[model samples]
Target: MRRTVARRLAAVLATTAVVAAGVAMSITNASAATGGVTGYATQNGGTTGGAGGATVRATTGTQINQALCNRASDSTPIIIQVEGTINHGNTTDVSGSSCDVGSTLIDLKGVSNVTIVGVGAGATFDQIGIHIRESSNIILQNLTVKNVKKSGSPLSNGGDAIGMESGVRNVWADHLTLEASGGEAEGYDGLFDMKNDTKYVTLSYSIMRNSERGGLVGSSETDLTNSFITYHHNLYQNLNSRVPLLRGGTAHVYNNHYVGIVESGINSRAGAKAKVDNNYFEDSKDVLGTFYTDERGTWQTSGNILDNVTWSAQGSENYPAGPSMPSTTTVSIPYSYALDNASCVPSIVAKTAGANKGNQVSDGSCNAQSPSQSPSNPTTSPTTGPTDPGTSPTNPPGGTNLSLGAGADGSSKADGTSYGNVIDGNMSTYWSPSGTTGTVSVKWSSAKTIDTVNIREASGTAGNIDNWQLVNHATGAVLASGTGAGVISFTAVSTTKVSFVITSASGTPRVAEFEVYA
Candidate 1:
């Protein structure tokens, strides 16, 4: 007999009635407002569970669960700060025949507007997972979910490192590192799985590595209620398949890096529509489209880079040949985000994506002032930094971020800080010239009209560019000269190259951002 996923999950899962009671109470106490937040907390489930409430600290899984249980019916959002490893209190008794549900774990069933964020080095969930059932407006960030086991244990929600199901909505998981040592046969399931009508979620800057099963949405082809999920800037490394096996939902996937997909990748079936854009896939096989299952899925692909990718031959079992993915539908993204060119994705993602312990995240399209918002709540960090002249502040307007994924040439560069940092839109990271007299330049494939340039001084390297020359390589014209970290405007000039030449400095010259605009 074929073992259906529903049979494996529902057989021992939490009862619908019991979950509904908690949800009902939560809804009753919840604010009439939706998941969106105001002011400082407009990103990531919009102040989920922590808005206008006191923060609670929990050290273990039981304490975390207890804190959530205490606010089971409260509308006032609470923030549960998790510190250290949340392990222990895992039960082995299976409730039913297959899924091994009803286990004593950190179950966030029947909760709303909750934020479980890891502090310091970030929280670790060792051999245990957080189950989000019948919950809404949740944020799980900076947490390392590893070693979620299924051996001799009644794994709730099919042993997912982070499982969401049954009316779950408005969840933002950022900077999480979800990994597993083994696959399902070794008692491990998906790193992250969403099923049974779960919707309106975003997974950004997270890392899913070294696991056989990465994640899946909508358990089976027939189970099509899940929808509206956005995955951006995530790194999927060393996975076998299902970097999401999407089913029956509109998933906007962009700027993700996939490496070492052993068997297949991105099984989109049962009418699921995936918009795959601007992603980098390296050393992966069949990185997109349906696999193993005969049910057909749909995807629209654009701006993707495939390097050293091998495709599985077309057969009855394999859905589509990869390296070039096929899609059945057109998808329009409902938010604003920056897309790094395929060539630049690897470098850009390496510097910007994943958990940067003490660093803030860039807004990769989550917050907007528009009132006519889609049910799918998006998130991005607030835009700050130097604006390119003659261009919009967010981007170079009509111009490109010349430094973006652009090859950097310098007289010399500091170790770990490459010349690319000067234009990656991140001020915290800078490109320090190896010596005080060294120069850094950004060139384009073709000539670009540039009239203004902005230079951000590295925090510790201020006054390094005491005297500098902005040289136009094409014309060998010194366009302008600067002595500080600010805008340097000059006459409009078209050139294929621009260089920041430090003529004098107090210390080693460091440029955080070297932006040009037309």
Candidate 2:
């Protein structure tokens, strides 16, 4: 299936090149100098053009590169208006190294105030969509970066599609689409990987899909606010792994939609404070909040609100909420389980109930919920103490647990292969189908480490299952297992489900009782 898709992409790229060749002939270079500032405008010779009434030849990759990169930084921001297709022809092929003839598409180093607009047709690239390094005040708008990956080289460089690295700031990425055209097994890199002290960055109205990693803000404190970074809108599909990993950064993620991710949807790890709110999710294995802290345990989640969010798993909770202080330095809402539309008022009413509630509530707002006040110390004021600014639950409930359960059958599969199993009053037992040979997943009620899982045989006789394995619900790592009837025992991390994958089963195997003892 992956090979078929790659072949189709190659064919499409070839056709696009043929069409682009005819259009490149009539392109005229319009260079203008105003107030001793010289700037060149390239108009598309093709039928489609840009807003600034400029068109350029699309024959050589250097022409596009020069239009975008070679611009005066001191002047009023070089505007490269791209109207038609910017084809980086099939870097998926083994012969190609970078996207085009150059090592990079747009290498902006120590340059500033550059604007690359796609107009209506939307810019398309085969590899390394836009590379920004040590640049500032750049705007990449109305573009689509598709079919980007390292095909020829064994060692793929960072940002196969689009990359921003090393002291880049004040860049706005809007209405962009980055897709890993390679299918699930291809193992491509992320759509966008911004790292190394990249600050004041905003990615909005963009779609990232079908890559090994979706869109990442890593190794630096970056701001990703008001963007739809997910797979549901057909941005990323047929992926075998997670999407959008936030590693070691302070990112504000809000108002996004995530759907049908195989692994962890959004991971906020390595002392990263992720302010998540007002997002909708569906058909996802894991939705949000995998907060990881280093030795300092400085990462925290605050003002991260999840409202009007829906799920597919039966009786599954939204996000586990509570006073969760993994270590002394960092305090976050580890598990917030709330029903749909329960409102922050109910959660606040539930957590701060009675005498403890009265002390924290002042003038209808939560005084204790402020960042300056620790969960252990409610008396501390919001202004005192060294508090993280982009931290706090934006909505109500002060970080409480609420479970809304699965929405519709079209959104999920009832194959009994979840890491956490939510056994509602309707269903008594869940089973994997006969002749199916893969991991079986069961989710738990809450986050708890697993000690043992009891699986009873339901119908078929148990065969020697040396090739079977059990995986953790949250992390998706294989756990230690010993065989007995259908019983498996392993160490637990959180109140997650235990999944069993049958590798070499002779006959149909059935499981009756699946229990996790904490």
Candidate 3:
């Protein structure tokens, strides 16, 4: 059956190329928006086909590389909708090494606004995965990348199924099945990795299985500035380490399922903070919060369920301790998103996580466009956290760091001061507007009482916020107004969200801390 399908696919591809030899080829509407990162990366939140652009159906490695290079040279957004198997037989190792030499790899370097989507059953990149570097605004969906083993090549791209590095930003990967033959001995590295200041990426509804290594963010501990990544509704199975071994970035990991983790999962180190929420881990060991090599890491967990987890020895290699629910660090997604209860994760994940052979995905909650949607017909009731996320169950004295792990957003983002940094418990790090004046906001799933708000300015004199007003999201009322980081006191009100709108500033005001306390 496999051989017959391959023969048919090869003949179709040959005919496609021959038919388009002398004529202008146009893309079909295969690049329709599939939600998640693809929607987020676009201005309309709608991904279109390579409209008004050339479309080429690439089957061999050379044809794929040529098509990509042609689109890249124009520096325009394109969609390279792929079909059939693209393997090492058609690719040459551009790494200039002997290991996996003459093997083909899809290297998207220095390109912008490109979408790679699968057509037909699914597009498979065999023996090599896509490598993205120095690029931005890219989307990859409905593809399978496997068997990427680089033997004898010490100078490879870490042999990852999909690797992004060096100023890469605004990427979305969805519905990908990235796998390997065995471990590093089998010549495969991480399934997905981002390093060297990669930011604003979301990996959703993907499957990574049967591999020794999972993934990593920030190649070194000193790579401090790279951050703002999200991992949601992914299935990680039979992995040993680097369940995204984060170094210095902040990651929002939610609704992911971890099964058969041999050694470790979610290795957070080098001052990285992982906001873990509503995930499921079963038949796995050391599922969360392992600090690897050096430097301590921090994680805040809420509504996570663990079952059949056998923890290993907890000392030496594992630093800063295991994954535990801390009092603070309650996360509120600033964007509209969906969640599936841990009890129903297995059922939903089985149908949605991997490549749907014929584009018939029973994606379950993974496709919910609203933040309030819960799993439909869950097998069991959703588990609740020890405390309500935003509300103080004890109602103790002015609850601690209400904004510590809350979801944050801003009118504009500039430099390395992201919206997440405003409430990240680090005054040294800040969130600045691209322009001199803009709004910065924080959100919560539930309402809470808040009376005090503090602002630490990145610039004390110049670039300080001269005039500002705090607005309530629910009532559309102005709560407080002040200038120049004055400690503002307001009547405590229960609200889901609030924002500080800056009317005037001395210069580009950088907010180091936006602390909300109740």
Candidate 4:
């Protein structure tokens, strides 16, 4: 039986029930009209059963904390809905009169499956957005958290927009916008912090502007995929930090577009293995800026850097702190075509591996080098002719292109010939009167690019075709020969020869068509 592959899809559910509960609870616990401070709380009704159950309604950070400390472990998820804005006058913005740093907006501990969405449009002047500790399965999606002071006072660590302590897991943070417009010394540190054993987390499709340190910091095993992370995309005029710091775990970083402003695109460390593929990095001063080595003293390694276009790395520097091990510090730019910059060159300098094995720069130019040839064997001609007149013409026709047709066994062909003369069965053999001692002419009309054509002994298994040859049709030279089917490719040129010959075969050889393209 023939084989084929299939595709997979993911699912998304509506938030109607969760939103309805929030609306009903908002009416009963409405705050006072004086615009001072109030308290409200609700829980997510999801059946997945984690810590995503709270909605709080404390205007002041102090009031929000008091409400959270009073909730039972299994009561329900708390939704902290701030009724009105509370402007504390303290500059530290933690626990005083200041709107910036009196108390944290919401502090979550030992919670799971909890989400904190915006209640209304004008929710503003909050303290730190959400502080999470030892939480799992929590989602903080669709909230506009801004004007957060990084540091409360002169001798403290700046408040992060969303801080995840040592034990967070399986967290999904999406569609969040954090604005830290405070001074450089007093601004927030990072938008999202995943440090100390935070595993199986995803930070996707969020925007951050003007953070003092960076955008995101993942210390341990984490997966950061499908995120639009760019300094230029953020509304801030000046970007002063790195995009993401992948410290541990095998991070899969793909499909992200990065434009650096002040630092490199990614700052990986401690022998992290990052699969960075299909990403567009444009005009970045640094790309893959710095990294640490593994326990074996091997520098930070990348899994595969496939199909990434780097516009410029003008101010970028390779790792090793000053390049003591020149071989270890050198970067591999695989499948990258670098233009301008004479020093930068394509990873695959030539068409084959032998041409690029040990050659170096000469006169600032690397010319075409010869590739190795395959082992030679006796060449033979096909012992068979076309099964029908349309495919094999006995008499000479003036410039009429001969085309193969569908075999009698229901195998479709471009030429549409309908006959059973062509052999189409396992262990089947057929021979034509048309034979050449030195060469064989096989013709077919195909719009697709023909790569490697295989001649298989039809009786063998799919992977065990007994007689095969790989011919470069453009150069008209036999490239390689093997035990299985024939493999042919178009070498920057087009051809109509869909046929091959087996000099000798352990069993009767059968022909099949295979095509490859650029």
Error of 3 at 393 (Å): 45
By lDDT, who's the top model here?
1
* TM-score (all chains, Cα) for each model: 0.60, 0.43, 0.62, 0.41
Off by over 4 Å in 1: 1-49, 89-103, 153-157, 359-518
lDDT of 4 at 138: 57
Off by over 4 Å in 2: 1-60, 68-70, 73-76, 89-104, 153-159, 183-187, 219-243, 291-518
Clashing pairs in 3: 91-103, 91-104, 92-102, 92-103, 92-104, 93-103, 398-518, 463-507
- In the order shown, what is each candidate's alpha-carbon RMSD? 17.4, 27.3, 16.5, 24.8
lDDT of each: 0.64, 0.40, 0.63, 0.35
Better of 3 and 4 by lDDT: 3
Pick the winner on TM-score between candidates 1 and 4. 1
Please give the TM-score that candidate 4 achieves against the real structure: 0.41
**Taking the tens digit of each residue's C-alpha lDDT, what string does model 4 give over 30-144?**
1111100000000111111122234455555465455445456423445454434533432223332211222434556665544443334423434545666676545554455
Model 3 lDDT tens row, 1-518? 01121223334334323322422312211111123231122222222223224556666666666566655343554567777888766765343211112345677777665667777666898777788888776677778998776674432445888998999877778778998767777678889998898887778778887778889898777877667778877888767778888887678887787766767788888777788877777666677765557576778887677766666555776653344545234444333333455555554455566665332222233332221111110112112111211221222235587888799996777766689978887655677766434678889988978887777664333224555667776765667754556456788888888887664343456677677888
The candidate 2 region of ten consecutive residues with least summed lDDT is: 35-44
Report the Cα lDDT for candidate 3: 0.63
